[model samples]
Target: MLSALQLHSRGWRVSVFDSGSAGRESSWAGGGILSPILPWNYPEAVWQLSRRSLPLYDALAPELAEATGVDPELTASGAMLLDPDQIQAGAAWCAAAGLAAPEIDAILQTRGPSLPGLLLPWIGQIRNPRLGQALRLRLRQLGIALHENTPVTGWLRDGGRVAGVDTAAGEHRGDCVVLAAGAWSGALGALPVAPVRGQMLLLRAAPGRLKRIVLDGGRYLIPRRDGRILVGSTVESAGFDKRVTGAAREELLAFAVGLLGTEAAGQVETQWSGLRPGSADGIPYIGEHPALPGLWVNTGHYRNGLVMAPASAELLADLMEGKPTQLDAAAYRLGAGRL
Candidate 1:
C-alpha cells in the first residue's frame, strides 16, 4: 500500500483487484496493534516487521490522511500484556528492547480477573477500518482503478511471461499481476497464499473504560479511541470457512469481561470473522513467481498484514523498482510449482 501510494505519487497508473470489496478483509478486520506489545509467541522476523513498520506509520500516516482526506486513526498510547509468570518475561523483553517502562504499574499487581501485566511504553495501534478507507480513497484519488467482487479466476499465459488474469467479469489485462488477494491466494492455483481463519469480536465499552491494549496469552484487547474494544482472535486452519462460532465468541467474551468486569459484558455490540492469509511459516511471500515471469506475491501475512503492510509494500516496491532488497527474499521466494 505504501509503495502503491508512492508510485501513485510518481504518476504510475495502479489498479487493485480484490475477490471481495477492497480492504474489507483482514486488512480492516485486524485488531490494529501497531505493536511492540506483541507476544513472545511470534518469531524474530515477525518481531522485526512489527519493530520496523510500527514506526513507519508516523512518517506516512499523516501524509496518507491528508492525501486521502480520511482519518486513519493511529496512536502510540503504550500497551500492557498479562499472564502472571509471563509478565516478568515480558518485562525483560521490553527493557531489552530499550522501550520506556512507565512507573504506572511497575510491581506485579495481584492477578485480579486476568494475569499480571506491564505497559510497554513504545507500543501503538491504528483504526484498521479507517486505514482501509483511507487507502481506498487515496488509490481512487490517484486514478487507480479497482475491480471489487471480481477476482482472478486463473492466469492467461503466453510462454515465459504472465499475459493477464482471468476473473469472474472476464479477462482483465495487465502488464504484470501482483497477488495481494490475501487468504484466497492459495485458491489461485499458483499462489502460495493459504487461508488462516481468525474469529474476532467488536465490543462497545463503557465511558473511560480500559486505557490500553491488554493481551494475555492468545487473546488480545485492542482499544479504539472511540471507546470501542476489539477482542479477538483464534488462529485456526479451518480452510476458507470464515465462520464465527459460538465457542470462540463465548470464550473471548468471558476472557475480556473477566478482566474489565461485568459492565463491559453486555457491551458486545457486534461479532464477526475474517481469514488471515498465512504461509507455511507465517511470513509474507514477497518475490517473483518461479513459474511465471512479471509476477510477484504479497500475501501470507497470517495475522500481521496490517502491521507489516508498509514494510511489505516497501519490499515489493524495491523489487518492482529493481532495487536491492534489505531483507533476504530467499525464504519469501516462490518455490518450484509452489506459486
Candidate 2:
C-alpha cells in the first residue's frame, strides 16, 4: 500500500492486487508498535529501516487523517520494557542510539510495579486497521486501482523482464512490478519465504488501568484508547495454518495474567492469529531480484512488517526510480546465503 501510494504520488499509475482484502493479514493483526520491542536486539538493517520508517509514521498518521478524513489514532503512548536483561542493556542501547535512559525505579513507578524495566518516552503506536482504511481511502482518492480479492496466479514475463501478472480475471501488465505478496510469496517460487503463525489475545482493561505498552519476557501488551488492551503473541513455525489453537490461547492468557495480574486477564474479549512472512534471515529482502530483471520484491518482512513498511517502501521507491537513497540499498539484495 505504501509503495503504491508513493509511486502514485510520483505520477506513476499504480494497481494493487491483494490475494485477499488489503490490510486483512499481518498489517491489520499487528500491535502497531512503530518501533521494535527491543530496539537493541535487532540487526543494523532492521534498525536502519525502523529509524527511517518511524519518522514517516509521525508525519503520515495525521497527514492521512486530515486528507482522507479518517484518523489513524496514532499515539505516542510510550513503552515499558519489563525484562531484567533488557533493562540492564538499556543504558548502553540508549547511549548508542543517542536517546534518554531513565532510571529503572522511575519507569517501574510510572508505568508498573510488575518488574524492573526501561522507559522509552519517544515510542508511539497506531491503530493499524484505521491506518489501512485511511490508506485505501487516500489511494482511491488518488485514482489508484485497488483490486481486492484479486490473486496473482503467476507472473507474465516478456523476454527477461516481468511484463505483468496473470490473475483470475486476465493479464494486467504494467511498466514495473513489485511483489509485496506477504506470506503467500512462497507460492511465487524459491524466494526463501515461509509463513510464521502468531496468535494474539485481546483483553479489556479499565481506561486508566494499563498505562502504556509493556514488553515483558517475550510477550507484549498494547493498551488502546478504548480501554481495550491487546496482549500478544506467540511466534511459531506452524506453516500456513492460521488456526488459533487452544494451547496457544491458554499460553498467551497465562503470560498476560502473569505480567498484569489475573484481574486484567479475566476480561478476555477475543483471540486471533496471523501468518507473518518469515524470511530466510531475520532481515527482509527489499531490493530487485539479482537474477530477475525488472522484477522487484518488497516482501519477506517477517514479524516487523508494520514497523518496517515505510522505509522499506522508501528504499524500494529509490531503487525503482534509480535515485540516491539514505540507506545502503545493496545490503538487502536477493543474494543467496543468510545474513
Number of the top-ranking candidate, with lDDT as the measure: 2
Tens digit per residue, CA lDDT, model 2, 200-227: 9999788867778888888988988887
State how far residue 10 of model 2 sits from its true place (Å).
1.2
Any runs in candidate 1 off by more than 4 Å, and if so which? 1-3, 36-39, 102-115, 336-339
By summed lDDT, which 10 consecutive residues of candidate 2 come out lowest? 107-116
Instruction: Please give, for residues 136-212, the per-residue lDDT of candidate 1 as tens digits.
Output: 88787767887788877888787778877888888877677787778877777466677888888889975457677
**Pairs in clash, predicted candidate 2:** none
TM-score of each: 0.90, 0.96
Q: What overall lDDT goes with each candidate model?
A: 0.75, 0.84
Residue 207 in candidate 2 has what lDDT? 87
Residue pairs clashing in model 1 are none
Best by TM-score: 2
